[model samples]
Target: MINEVTRALVAHLHSRTPDLGSWVVVHSLSAADAAPAKDKLALCLLAVDEHDHLRNSPPVEVAGRLQRAPMQLRLSYLVTYFGPHDEAMARLTRVIAVFHTTPVLGQDELPLTLGEQVERVTVRLRNTTADERNQVWSVLGRPGRLALFYTVDVAPVRLLPGLDGDGRVLAHRIDLAGTP
Candidate 1:
């Protein structure tokens, strides 16, 4: 699902600016750094966390059996520029503009890779302190140049079926306050 979101963003970027070419990609800095391209921007997965919005999602009925709700996740990515500073910055500006215009990707925009439960994905810029930024760069083993931080919302991870039993209120036991 994470890859699906990134892929959707890549396609969106390509569609918005054909002049930018197909330089928008999803790859690790450590891997790409070895064989870097002349003009490219890598959208690297930075982190992932559970989305609290659907903490208590309703059970889904599939094949007459109620299945546990899919786990919702939020993903973070860093758009790092590689190549000449001037041209890269110009392209990054366009990238910002594109995202600014369309920050959310819905079922109409997203590929089929996303689960049926996931209706849409939200993208937004994430603000971080200098120390936090330094920490992230240090972990990635790259000297900070220029990067765009973004967080994509709500990727559903489907869990296995076969819940213990038919989900129902079998019985209601009522106890009086004075009764043991």
Candidate 2:
């Protein structure tokens, strides 16, 4: 589900800025370690944090059956521009500008899987402390490089199908006469 969102963003970026079509790449942080080519930029999904807004929500009704609500997830990504120091920074700047303009992605912009279930997704810049940023690179066993942190929120990832049960109110008795 999350992969689709990432791919959609990459596609959108490519469409908006045709120049970056071949230069932009999306992959996981671990994957990036395997291929450290300095020519292409990468958007790495570093982590995912689940949101608590609907964490405890009860099962929702779907087609008259009770189905579990999908957990909302916040995807963290590290956008790294690779190449000469100045050139990399320049590409990074362009990446930031693109995100700044399109902070939110509507359903039409998402993949069919996400578009059908999620209403919208939000992309925001995450400011990380030096220590925190260093920790991420350390975990990957790679030296720190120029990168920007971003968080993408995806809601209701419904993985389970609706359970078979009767949820409809068959009848209701009125006690307007002050009787229990």
Candidate 3:
């Protein structure tokens, strides 16, 4: 099932990227609370705001001057605006947020059984940047696969039903300073 999932994702990516463009594929396994759905697997894609159309907007400044009877002063004027690149960046960010938080269930290779029952699978965004995370949430609340550019990191995880079990969480929060 994992192999099939990987193939499906690769196919999907191939369809999205044009002949001149490209995308890299990645995979990982870590401790998780739930297994991937029968047909769908959790995925993450990272992207930068490189679209020129949406990111063209930059702060602008103009020269200004004030004059009094005996003194003259000059100051800079400030302007805030949005360009094509900015819009694209914002839209891409929103798309990523939705994909990370939304749970899609189907067929999967991972054997997921909780106690005696066949547990339902769900995908969740454990931790992420605020802006990127919120965008994923918004899209998750809606329907359909999100469209955007993103970098992906995959990890396998074991989900334990109880604290007494031996399954350990492989992913942990770390500070920017490198402290765990």
Relative to the unseen true structure, what is the C-alpha lDDT of residue 160 in candidate 3, on a scale of 0 to 100?
32
Sorted by lDDT (best first), the order is: 2, 1, 3
Off by over 4 Å in 1: 31-35, 58-66, 115-117, 163-180
lDDT of 1: 0.78
Cα lDDT tens digits for candidate 2, 1-180: 778888877877777688765777875657345755667888888877787676777767778665566678888889887788898898888878888999888898887877997878888988999999899888877778889999888876775544443255568998777767
Least accurate 10 contiguous residues by lDDT in model 1: 160-169
lDDT of 1 by residue, 1-180 (tens): 677777888898899899767878777776336635768888888888888787788887766666666778888888877888997788789888988999987887877656365778888988978888888888878788688888888757776555463354558999878966
Model 3 misplaced regions, further than 4 Å: 27-126, 129-180
Candidates 1 and 3, the one with greater TM-score: 1
RMSD in Å for candidate 1, one decimal? 3.7
Error of 2 at 70 (Å): 2.7
In terms of lDDT, the best-performing candidate is: 2
Write down the lDDT of every candidate, Cα atoms only: 0.78, 0.79, 0.32
TM-score-based ranking, best first?
A: 2, 1, 3
RMSD of each: 3.7, 6.2, 25.2
Error of 3 at 28 (Å): 4.9
Give the Å shift of residue 53 in candidate 2: 3.0
* Backbone clash total, candidate 1: 0
